[model samples]
Target: MKIAFVANTCWNIYNFRKGLVHHFLSKGDEVIVLAPKDEYTDRIKSWGVKWLDTPLEGTSVNPFREFKYLLRIYSIFKSERPALALTYTIKPNIYSSLVSKWTPTKVICNVSGLGTIFLTTGLIGKLALILYRQAFKFSSYVFFQNSDDRELFTSKIKVESYKIGLIPGSGINLEQFKPLAFTQNTKTKFLMISRLIIEKGVREYAEAAKAFKDDKNVAFTLVGKFDTNHSRSIDEKELKQWITNGWIQYQPHSDNISNIIESHDVIVLPSYREGTPRTLLEGAAHARPLLASDVPGCREVVKNGYNGFLFEPLNSSSLINKMKLFLSLSIDEKKHLANNSRELVEKNFDEKLVVDAYEEAIHRIIKVS
Candidate 1:
């Protein structure tokens, strides 16, 4: 059987769905990927699957461009006619499922998060909800990363309850992210890894870091690339100002994330919302404590005061308080938090669980077809 995985970027599919893709390929199923070409595109193609470049403008709302995107997806579905299509991100989930209605393919949409659209009250939000409802009507299944998202979609968009399923946000690979030895350093290190975007709480993180600027024993590091294309992106000027102020140490995005996570004592994410953040899961897998906003996807990973702390979203003072609390912890207490982080990932967010879920869904689709 042939299966297709579609998303906005090859980077997303490569990082999040590679395990599932490998699972199907190992079982003798032909796997194809449809996403925009990026540095990871060649890497994914090297896995012995066909790669088709499907250009997408993620944040654009122009009707003509959207129509062109839809037509491109329709053409792909009509030509390739895969047995099953698993889609991620907003555009692929919405457009691919809509195309599936007229094609021989069956689509399974993954609702990673509500994103900015569902968070606001506007005409665009209403129109997006309508599109989701119509597109999901043709989808074979819709998997949500968190229960909060599932409830919201069901309540607001009225998707069929029978078609809804919940899975951990692109489960973490435990073997790949083995816990590192805990070493007490002279300085306590705190790190936040995310795109430099306002919605991700970059400003909050910087402000919180400022509170610790005078402390010689504390260090704060921010790792991620500046996304100039995103509307919510933090501009280079703001980032430079933060660096000049010596609030936090900034590092450009690195492919060696595990190495960076191992070096940090604690991981922090102050984002307003998320669809299961991979960084938190990766941090936990490395036996690093977490400090994140008490938002939906983050709360599911951080059991406040267990594996880590949860602060108020978008509140710099709240984040500063949490950092102070962490700084006050004894070495043993810090180690306990780190241990619990690894234990939580083992119990709930192993990559095997995600692979199994996808395999089961694939089997059901094949049987039906």
Candidate 2:
């Protein structure tokens, strides 16, 4: 069987969905990635998967560029005609599904996150909603990361409820992310891992970092790509100035995500919204307490005082308060939060569950093929 996984970036496929890709390959199915090549493209291809660099102007408003993206997707699908297609992010999901009806491929779309477009009702938002309705009409199944997203699509896109499935946000491998024995670090470090985008609350994080610059017990670190082309990206000069003033230690994006989490006492993501934050799941798997916004995806991860804390979505002051509270925790309380985080992951977010569900779905398509 030939299976194609599509996303906006190869890094997304490499980071979030690699476990599922490996599962299919282990069963003797050929896996191919359809996305724009990035630093991780060659690395993922080295795993014996094929790569096709399908480019789209990520934040462009030009219709000509979008039409070109559609044609490129259709050309690829018409040629390869994979047994199945799994698409994440907006453009891939929409364009791939639009072409699936003309090809033999069965389409499954994962609505990872709604993104900033849905947060407003501007012209672009209206256009996106129209495109989604047309594209999703061709999808064999639509998997949403959360129930909120499913409901929104049902009401807005008018897609049938039966066509929608709920999967945990790109599940975490329990065995691989097994908790290391709890060790106390001399300085309590808080790490925020995400794209340097305003929607991820990068601005709020920076503000919080600035407020706590004088604290001796707390240290803040940030790790993720600085996407200059993104509409919501933090200004390069501003980000550099933050690091220069000793507000936050910045690390270049690296493949060693597990090690980075291990070194930090707590993991934070102040995202404005999420499908289900993979960061929180990974952090919990490492027995690190989580601090995140109380939005749909994030609140599900942190159990208030049980495992970690949650603050108002865009409130830097609220974020600062939570940081102070974390810093004031007793050693025993901190230990309990770490244990609770790991326990929550084991009970809920295990990667095996997600893999099993997808494999079953794919097998159904294979039988008829």
Candidate 3:
């Protein structure tokens, strides 16, 4: 079978779903990637899969740009003629679903997250819902990372009930993200891994860090890219200010990010929303306790007072309070919570389970075809 994956960017495929692609290839299926080429394009090719560059105007609300992206993807779909087409993220799921409806190939769309458009009330939000309702009409299966997103799509946009299925966000690899020893030594390091954007709670983390900077034993670190999509992105000026003020240590994004996870004592993400946060799963798989917002995606992974704690969305004081709780945990207590985190991930968010779910969905579609 030939499988084609349509996502927003090559980076998304490389960072989040490489394991899924490899799983497909190992099963002797021809895998093709249809998305915008990036620095990771060559790396995908190295996996012996075909990479088709489809230009996408990400975060653009212009109808003309959307039409162009649809045309480009439609051309690619017609040419590739794969047995199945899997789409992820917002634009690809909407456009690819519409394009594949006329083709003989089966289409599966993953609604990774609702994103800011759906969360914010405006003309754009209404337009996005309309597109989603229309696009999902013909999809074989629309996989949601969380039940809340599924509920929102059905309740808000009123998509057909039979079209949706639930899966934990791109599952974590148990072996790759093995449990790390949490040696609560002299100083405790807290890590927040996410794109530096307002929606991601980057500002909240920074604020909490500032509030806790006086405590010599507590240190904060941030790992992520500067998101240019949102207005609240930590611009160079602000990031430099925080760094100079010694609020938190900042690290740029990278593909090989395992070492960074291993180096931290705890993980925190104050995201306003998420699909299934890959970083949170990674931290949990590494058996590191977490601090995240009490939002849909984050809440699904973290059971408050168990493996991790959840703060009110966008509340810096709540985030600070949670960080202090983490700070107060003794070495043995931290270790116990860390172990619980690994157990939760192994049972619920294993990468193998995610791959199996996708494969099963594909097989079911093929049987019907």
Best by TM-score: 1
Candidate 3 Cα misplacement greater than 4 A, ranges: 229-232
- Candidate whose lDDT is highest: 1
Query: Over the stretch 228-272, how does candidate 3's per-residue lDDT look in tens digits?
Result: 675556777888889999999988886667788888888899999
How does candidate 2 score on lDDT?
0.86
lDDT measured at residue 174 in model 2 versus the true structure, 0 to 100 = 89
| Model 2: how far residue 149 lies from native, Å | 1.9
List, residue by residue over 286-318, the lDDT tens digit for candidate 1: 999999999989999999999999999989999
Between 1 and 2, whose TM-score is larger?
A: 1
Work out how many backbone clashes candidate 3 has: 0
Candidate 3 global lDDT? 0.85
Looking at candidate 1, the ten consecutive residues that score lowest on lDDT are 360-369
For residues 1-369, could you state the per-residue lDDT of candidate 2 as single tens digits?
888998998988888998999998888888888998788899899999999889876667698988998888888888887889999988888889999978888898888878755765666677878889899999888888888877766788877766778888898998889896556778889999998988898889999999988878779999988988877788999999999989999986877899989889999999988888998999999999999999878887889998999999999999989988988888888889999999998887888878877867666556844
Per-prediction TM-score to the true structure, in the order listed = 0.97, 0.95, 0.96
